[model samples]
Target: MRVPVVVKVGLFALAVMGIYTYYANSIPQIQSALPEEISLEAETVTPEQLVRVGEELFKGKGTCEVCHRIGQVGARAPDLAGIGGRAGTRRPGVSPTAYLVESLLQPGAYVVEGFPNIMPRVDRPPIGLNRSELWAVVAFLESLGGEVRARLDDIPKTAGVPAGEAPVAELKLPGDPEAGKAIFMGKGGCVACHKAGPLGASPVGPDLSEIAKIQTPEYIMAKILNPAAMGTVAGYPAGVMPPTLGQTLTAKEYVDLVSFLLTLKGGA
Candidate 1:
């Protein structure tokens, strides 16, 4: 998808990650960094220490920066530069701490404008952050533009996997990306509406040049089969993409399409 012009913010916001620097010479290294279980079990961990660990979790295990960045106007999620202060005002009568906690634990409770309500709950499986980890992440976010007053008790101990939720990210299908590109530009008719970098420029759908960066592989797979259930991008009409994609494409074609989409993390 096409990323909008990024409005540069403060130094904190301008801390563009080394690997994500666009149009660079070297190719990026793509590999899985499984969630490393961090045990912050002691209550004696300082607020400053928690903030440090939270920063690590956000960048690494939490995989937050894949969708959110500090300075840039986020395409998938909200710009978290001054979120420490902006969060309190997100919902009336909602404290900054409460807002952050609810946003992470229950993302759909309050969706930001222009962004879809596709945020998966951070406390669930796959991204299961323990109670203390939740406290640390919230503390780290609070430190962004406000005072760090989040105590360990701010996060609920019962926050865990729902009864029926599955680990969607674990599903792996090695589809040929080259074959998928063909399906996208020709057979799949994706290029008719969507913009895949310089491949197409139809305003009918959102630019998908960076879909992999902002979304998960499973989401892209499911969206093709059922666009309505995945939710639509803001400013775009819903029910436009064909709902019969699953029935229309052969199993090989579907796999190839997802493989191609997964490689769209910007041409750099």
Candidate 2:
């Protein structure tokens, strides 16, 4: 008996789907890993514990291991071996601990010789770390070859963000600052390079707490829409910010983020 054309077609279709399913399953899947929140109870954490957590952050959330190496030469960043001892000498009048904080917060402040300035502030988004986590990273770096004297106070708190609140830019722009903040910390990922508070204190938040007070409203708007045209900050890398930011965000998101940024008076 001859198979009906419809039945043969159905079988072929099923076989094609089966092969597709098999092929798809055979291919390895890729997924981006989001960093886990690192929380340390400061009152109860010990120096050793801090170092361990710091190591974890260095390896994980901090993403330092991507460009840094413990004892080997880093093609991207500097070899961190004995960095604790050498950190003080990196800059005159800057102590080992102070230098570490500065590097984590203001990566462009000091670029290592022969290395391009590309290190992002660990306290900012993507790697957004709170004060305690930043302290842990510093302690971890110090543990390599120097004294782990990094203190919690070394990290400064943003003005209005200490309470997880956005600053009162009180601008006439019609956008929700709170919603914009969510975009900053969420979709916009602006917190990665700029801080509008809420990242939790000094060295931990990437330190752009006073953007509104320092920048004019017109400049802020233009900067967000066309960063390359606005020009880079003195110490930061040129073209570091995404030029596609305006394209990526919805109009409301862009407005909200701008309104939120305008409110960041850094406690006036």
Candidate 3:
């Protein structure tokens, strides 16, 4: 007896699915996981070890290879083959270490003649490198053709600040600014480091007196979730902002805090 057309179609579908499943299972399974934060503050690392770590970060977490190429010209960024040796001479009266640190921290401060100001601050969230990582990366870059003399102190205290440009569109959060302000001062302990309009008076972190005016809501939210990825504000220390705020606060609490921050518009 002839089988129904539906049965034939079903069988074909089953076979296709089975083949796909088998093929998927046969291939190597590669899982992409987020890079873990590394700190060498307390650890004693040699120059060689530091360079190795820096190389890994550049290729992996630092994402430097995305735009910067060594030896060859890049479409987005300058080739870094001899950036170490060339860094000092690029600016008048600037040391190689200082120039490199500034390039990483405040890329827009001095744009290379042919390149656009597109480099992100390395010490902030998204690429939120700590002092240790920054030190290592600088050393790695310096080793390209120059001396590896970049120290932990070379990176400025306020190296990473959220980009000053506002978002194309604003986000409307369903949170109470009053509640967020309360959390900032009391439960969140943000007031200990940051200076908001009237709630906080701390000098340890960047002043948020006008954060809402300068940054996008998306940036503020992302910074809260992943401060390292967002980058540090210039003139502030890296890694001081804990990366645990997303995990520590409830959804409402986080939203409320962001709303409160958005209210801060310096002189606006």
Candidate 4:
């Protein structure tokens, strides 16, 4: 008696799936959990502690290194090797602390020569560094080549509005969510880092199972076009999201992907 073709095909598919699942589970997993907000107003934090927290934000939430490099010149932004020491000198009338604070709150105001004025305001959404976070970041920058003189008051009161509540431009996407899900699992490479319901199990980036519930459609679209500008999600390393998704994907594909992402409202 000959074995049935259907049975053989089913066995082969199962074997392949088992191998893939085993390999995925065997790899090192890195979950990108969201960072908790820090409030310095109520707590008494020392300068040393502040600087430490500032450094973490720079690499994590602030997402400064995505463009600005320390000790090395960057392609996107200026090398901040001596920003602290020369910040005061950049604008003769302004002090170093004031300069740093201004630079973070209003990056486009003083675009460094040779680099485009693409740096987003750190206090704005996506990156959304809060007042306390901004204060610490300035302290960290000052430590590079100048003294730490930044205070809580240095950061503008209006800066660092929480991103979730911020107003976003209304978008009307005209792409199929089902096709977008296919692209997400195949060409988009999002499944490798993010977990979107049943599509993925990777822990490399933040779980996007509930992304639509928390983020606005405008933010999602902008983030796809400019990951660095949107800023790194807290707890995830900076520069991990590819910045070329906007260019690599066709306009329709981009819209479809965004549409699919919008459907991921958690709990499937």
lDDT of each: 0.71, 0.65, 0.69, 0.71
Candidates in order, TM-scores: namely 0.62, 0.48, 0.48, 0.55
* Clashing residue pairs for model 4: none
State each candidate's clash count.
Answer: 4, 5, 21, 0
Between candidates 2 and 4, the one scoring higher on TM-score is 4
**Model 3 local distance difference test score:** 0.69
Tens digits of per-residue lDDT, candidate 1, 193-265, equal 9988778989788788867655655467667877888888656788899887666676677777878887786
Clashes of 2: 5
Can you list the residue pairs that collide in candidate 1? 1-207, 1-208, 1-209, 1-210
Instruction: Report each candidate's C-alpha RMSD, comma-separated, in the order given.
Output: 13.5, 20.9, 20.6, 15.1
Which structure among the candidates has the greatest lDDT? 1
Error of 2 at 59 (Å): 0.4
10 residues in a row with least lDDT, candidate 1: 5-14
Cα error, residue 120 of model 4, in Å, equals: 1.4
lDDT of 4: 0.71
Please rank every candidate by lDDT, starting with the best: 1, 4, 3, 2
Which order, best to worst by TM-score? 1, 4, 2, 3
- Candidate 4 residues 1-268, lDDT tens each? 9966544543543453355345433431211223476777668888888889999988776767655678885224678888889898888789999889989878767867655455666664445677788899999999888988788888877766432333333233567899999889999899999899887899777778766544445557667777888765544678898876755676667768878997875564
**Clash pairs (backbone) in predicted model 2:** 125-191, 125-192, 156-202, 157-201, 169-263
lDDT of 2 at 145: 86
